[model samples]
Target: MPGTERSLTMRFLAEPKDVNFGGKVHGGAAMKWIDLAAYGCAAAWSGKYCITAYVGGMRFVQPVLVGNMVEVEAKVIYTGRTSMHLGIEVRAGDPTSSEKHLTTHCVAIMVAVDDKGKPVPVPEWVPVTENDIFMRDSAIRLMRMREKITEEMSAHLS
Candidate 1:
C-alpha cells in the first residue's frame, strides 16, 4: 500500500555469520540491510516498484558486534519527478540493552519504475519539522554533488 509516511526501519539481530574475520559485522552485510531498508521506504512512498539509481556517502562510524541488535533506518528527504532521495542510518546495540551507537550512514537515490521497468513518477514529499528540513537540505546537497561528479566524469570521457 502507498503511504504518506516519510521513514521506515528494519531491525534484526546480528549473527555470527554476519561477522568478518576481524570479529565485527561485515560492512557488505550492513550495506545490504541499508539497501533493503531504502527499498522498503521508497516502494512504500511511491506505490510502485523501485530501483536503486545511486548510493552515496556511505561511511562507517563504528563496528557492530555479532550479537547486537541492529536497526537500519531509511528516511525520504526529497523527491524529484521519478526519483526519491533517501537518507539511511544504521545503529546497533547489545540485544539486551537500550543503548545504541551509530554504525553507518549513506544516501540512496531510488527511482520508481513501471511494469516495463521504465522510470515513473514518485509522490512528492515535504519536510514539515526542523529535523526533516535539515535532512531534506542535506539530501539536496548530496544530489548536487552527484550531478557534479557525473558532469565531471562525462567531461573526462569526452
Candidate 2:
C-alpha cells in the first residue's frame, strides 16, 4: 500500500461556534481543518507518524459562514527525504447549493518521524500524468522561492 494515497478530502459544516459575531467563521478555524487534512494525507502516504514543519502561501480568499458546508482537500504534490508537500484547499458553500467558493489555499510540508521524534525517510512520490507532474513542479518552484526569499531577507537584515 505504499505510495497509494495521493489525496484526501474532508467535509464539515460551519457551526456558530466556529464563527464570530459577524456571522463569519474565523480563518484560524479553517486553518485547523486544513492542517487536519494535510496531516491525514501525509500520514497515509508515509505510513508513519508525521509532524507539520511548514505551511506556506495560506491565503483566505473568502470567509465561511455559519450553516455553510466546507470541504477541505489535501493532495500530495511532492516529497523529499523526509518531507511531503501537500497542496491544500478549502471551499465553502450553502448546503443546498451545488457550488462552492474557494476559501483558502496553501501548501504544507510534513515530516515523517520515528519513535524518537526525529525525521525519517519517506517513500518518494512519482508523477503519473501531466497534471501530476505540474503539481509536483509547482511545489518544487514554491520551495525554491521560499528559499530565495529567506536568503534575500537574511542578507538585507545582517
Candidate 3:
C-alpha cells in the first residue's frame, strides 16, 4: 500500500544562539527539526497521534551556516499495519541569494497508538503517482536497512 505526501516547511533563521563556536549550526539542533517535521508527516498520514518507533539513515550532506535558513520536509513513503514510514529532508537556504541546498536526509518509522498506548492499524493508503512510487520504494529500502541494523544491534547486545 502507498501513502500520501504530507510536507511541512519552515524557514530557520540561524541566530548566534543556534550556532556552535565554529559558526556552524549544531547537528543536534538539525536533528530536532528533522524529528519535528517527520512527526508531523506521520501524524497527518495516520490522522491520529503517533509515536516514533525508529529513526534511520540520517546523513549530513552539508553544513548549515549561522545565517542559513533551514527548511525541513517530511512525507509518508509507506505504511504497514500500525507503522508509517516517513522520509525527511533538511535543506539550507541562503536568504541573500534565494538558493536552497540539501543538507540532510533521514527516515523515520512511527506507529499509531490507541489511548492505551498500544499499536493500532492504519487505514489503507493509495499512491497513484510516480512520486508516490518513488516514495514507496524508498520506504521499502529504508525498512530493510532498519531490519538489518536491528539485527546487527541485537547480535552485539547478545
Q: Residue 23 error for model 1, in Å?
A: 1.3
User: Which pairs, if any, clash in model 1?
Assistant: none
Candidate of highest TM-score: 1
Question: Candidate 3 residues 107-138, lDDT tens each?
Answer: 88888888899998886565669999888987
Q: After superposing candidate 2, which stretches have Cα over 4 Å from the reference?
A: 152-158
Over 53-152, each residue of candidate 1 has an lDDT whose tens digit, in order, gives 9898999999999999999999998999999999999999998988889999999989999999999988889888999889889888877888889988
Q: Ten consecutive residues with minimal summed lDDT in candidate 2? A: 149-158
For the record, the alpha-carbon RMSD of candidate 3 to the native fold, in angstroms, is 2.7
| Shift of residue 93 alpha carbon in model 1, Å | 0.7
Give the lDDT of residue 4 in candidate 1.
Answer: 83
The superposed Cα distance between candidate 3 and the true structure at residue 58, in angstroms, equals 0.8
Give candidate 1's error at residue 31 in angstroms: 0.7
Candidate 2 lDDT over residue span 51-152, tens digit each:
999998999898999999999999999999999999999999999997999999999999999999999999999998999999999999999899998888
The model with the greatest lDDT is 2
Each model's lDDT comes to: 0.92, 0.92, 0.79
RMSD of 2: 1.9
Cα-based RMSD of the predictions, in order?
1.7, 1.9, 2.7
TM-score of each: 0.93, 0.92, 0.87
